[model samples]
Target: MAANALLKTQSPTFASPNSALDNIVLEYSISYFLIDLLHYLIFFPTDILFILHHLATLYVFLTCRYIIHHGAFAFFMLLILAEVTSLCQNIWTLAGFRRADLPAAAKLYEFLSPPFYALYTLVRGILGPLLVYKMVVFYLSGVAENLIPRWAWVSWMFVIITAILVSIVWVFDHWVDWFKGRNYKAAKKVV
Candidate 1:
């Protein structure tokens, strides 16, 4: 992440999306695959949506790196933005599981929950809809520029669209509850 941030600050690749492998993208791809693997083995049906999301993310990154040749800059930026609150999400969930006996941990989770929800809504809710719009624009502009096999491009776009739809629904489902002061404490586990 430090390297990715440094590169973003020092080296602008806006006009020309590099075809070379970015360390950050590579790292994220590996991490997502590992997460998918673990979830597939451990949770299976319990968190099938997350497992599918992870798989789709891994597929998108792998295809972007190896097959598709367009939109690295946009993809990397989206990936970074999407993961900005990952640490907070992990900590919040872990705190939930352990908070039953740890008063300090519960206090910390409570303090962090509001900010986490805010960030989640901003990125996964608002930005996600914007991304779906961009996807449409990009497709209409020229899906051919992607240069990958037709099946790969189609599947990637399909995954993204479905993910965005899921995110929108999830956000709407949770927003009222969040505002009502009933947090995920009793909600379905995301896993």
Candidate 2:
């Protein structure tokens, strides 16, 4: 009964859409898929070579950005380049996974296999911070007055410290797990 209710809540229903509209939607989907494949082929390099180039590109970009006193326009251009490269890298990754037949697509599907709640959580976690930060930055830039209070700055400092401490702890834990392997098994068991 619970599973049935879950399925009902999750499943999409087409409430008698006209045949013409349905055909249009199908045509759009096919076009989108073809375009995606074309982009993948044209933009992305093959597997190992692409990985090496991706890493090299990232290193060069970061090094140059850090060393050079580029204007905002230059920074923006670099950001755009980074975005395009990243997109191409992702496409190459997906293609490599597909060619390897290493359950690449299945792994993505499995991430939200439990359905609606799992999908919701995944989307929320990924997009929530991104949307919030974009809005905050936009608003902060527009308004001259400091939106974040002095106290809020202190709170942020604390959060940063806590994050650093947590990361350190995680690194130590992972190191211990690697050394013992028993600890790794125990950690997985706890999870």
Candidate 3:
């Protein structure tokens, strides 16, 4: 989807009508988020953050797919930025969960951590914000008000901005931990 968005000569805009491909992508994304939201609600009921994230994501996809029938291009591009590091991050997280019990998992976690963190930081902290800024600029210009309503774009921006902020904070916390561990190791060596 991201490749499609990037490679298309005639780029779809926030106001462009949904293509057949866009509908497929939007439906798949909506289903994934809905199922994940249900899982969190049932098993991790107290996991408010994940639940809210899923809900917010569903809102964006649902609105884009059903309500506005536009903005798939924007959503697809953002999806690319948001999910580029998901596989690596997921592997790292799974390894982390088992690291204490298994030496191999620990090794894998250690090996993957730095690269994953770097990629994630670059994508979420830098690229994501850049793309979002462009999206915001376009949306706020009121060019697409007829196709995509003001309220929809404004709410989407709110959700996107909040998600990005949370991602930045999450990655920053990891970076702090990594630096502290490195410093501690260096001090221990000196001692």
Candidate 4:
């Protein structure tokens, strides 16, 4: 849906107004965030990072949907990029949660960790930042001033950069852990 909206736009910038398709996609994303926020609040209340992330995301989507009625192009692009790894991430996370108790889950977790980390790092660390840098540069050039106010774009940048940094740190930690485990196994085998 988001990709379709982006494709339909003749030439999209960060400040493009919300089309009907854009609104539909934005609404779908908004619903996802809202439900996910509630899930976090109910089941994972201690996970403040995810909670705050959901809140910040909701703020961006809601403002774009109702208040500004623009910026869907940038947000939708970011959404598609961010979600590209979600399936793999979710599987890895579920396996991680059950790994200690289930042998099958342990195997799955071990199998998926490296690939998940690599894919996540590539998307969140490299591609995401490049796109956001473009957004920052475009907005800083003051071309979108009439469409998206300074406050809106600034807030969006803050949320996006923060989220990407957190994701990078998370995947980096996994990579470190994976390497350490491999080295431990190799040392034990030599002994």
Candidate 5:
């Protein structure tokens, strides 16, 4: 009985192209408007906080180098990155929610929720490998002028590159699915 219900729910016959397009446009427009307002208002204070925290960390790192060892330094950098990422993710989430983008909002909610907390854990876990990779690359490159080691900079560069690649791939994959007239698995599930 459950299988039958699932099959019925999953059936493409229930899906309406016009409705889906309307939903997408509506959600996008709402989110864009809300985010634009948030970008100007709430984000300004958040940005100031981030800047202050970053500057304070830099100042402490410079003046109190003797107190904080290499491991501690690495940990501090990771903390800062986590804070910044969290803030950005929150903004993204708010935009998604405001826009009524259910899937994106759901994903972000799951990421932030206590039961999952996957996004936070994933971000933290990635930092370790990133720090190591950056350290090695920076050491080889022979540039260590900033409070954050060259490794942190390199890791950030890699992160930006990966984000761009993933976004491109996602867009291409979605385009392919659209042209093929196939509902994505997630969208199918929604029906």
Candidate 6:
């Protein structure tokens, strides 16, 4: 991604066409996001916000990958920002489901929670907005403005708004106690 940033500056047009890596990432995102949305229908029936989020994710990915492929370099940079927390979220979620009665698993889970939450906040909460700004302000302000159509921009705006609302709800419901310095206890059940 850093290399992509360099390329962005070097490109004669300031943003390059979508690369193979971008396509690969988009495909993976579409697959995983749809799978997650489906899983939420059964396992996390109450997590309606996340389900909606996943739907928005697929909408954005599919739209960008096929329908509107302009401003892709900038968009790819934003996608990389989104991926910064992938390892942390995956490890936290996967390890959270393990039997913490096992000493090793317990320690691993314990070790991951703080970093996971911190990284999640930084990448998703902070960087997500940066992505919106770049897409709307930088990308649109530049010559690539015509690359992304008005309807696509409108659709992306809706997705981003939904994402922000979901993030607010998620933080309040799940992370507020942590931020308030409440004592930690291993979750008896993991989702």
What are the lDDT figures for the candidates, one per model? 0.66, 0.36, 0.87, 0.92, 0.42, 0.66
TM-scores for the candidates: 0.72, 0.22, 0.92, 0.97, 0.24, 0.70
Q: What are the RMSD figures for all models against the true structure?
A: 6.1, 22.1, 1.8, 1.0, 21.9, 5.6
Ranking by TM-score: 4, 3, 1, 6, 5, 2
Clashes of 6: 0
lDDT for predicted candidate 3 compared with the true structure: 0.87
lDDT of 6 by residue, 13-66 (tens): 323555566666667768888888889998998987677778887888788778
lDDT score, candidate 4: 0.92
lDDT, candidate 5, 1-191, per-residue tens: 21222233321221111133333333343344355545545656556534443443343333223322222333244445455455656765475465455766666654444322344434544554475456456545654433335454454445444443443454356446444543566677788
Indicate which candidate wins on lDDT: 4
Point out the higher-scoring one by TM-score: 4 or 6.
Answer: 4
Model 2: colliding residue pairs: none
User: Once model 4 is optimally superposed onto the true structure by TM-score, how far is the C-alpha of residue 62 displaced, in angstroms?
Assistant: 0.9
lDDT of 1 by residue, 1-191 (tens): 53464355433432134434464555566676777679676866677778778778877777666555444555566666677868988998889778899998888877887888788888877886686567656655654444445575567668877887787676676567666656455454543
Which of the predicted structures, 4 or 6, would earn the higher lDDT when compared with the native? 4
Pairwise lDDT winner, candidates 1 and 5: 1
**Where does model 4 exceed 4 Å of error?**
none
Once superposed on the true structure, which residue ranges of model 5 sit more than 4 Å away at CA? 1-43, 46-49, 64-103, 110-112, 115-191
Model 5, residue 46: displacement in angstroms?
5.7
Scanning candidate 3 in windows of ten residues, the lowest lDDT window is: 2-11
> In model 1, which runs have C-alpha deviations exceeding 4 angstroms?
1-18, 43-45, 146-150, 180-191
Q: Is candidate 3 or candidate 6 better by lDDT?
A: 3
TM-score for candidate 1, residues paired by index: 0.72
What are the clash counts of all predictions, listed in order? Answer: 0, 0, 0, 0, 1, 0
Scored by Cα lDDT, where does model 1 land?
0.66
* Highest-TM-score candidate: 4
Q: What TM-score would candidate 2 get against the native? A: 0.22
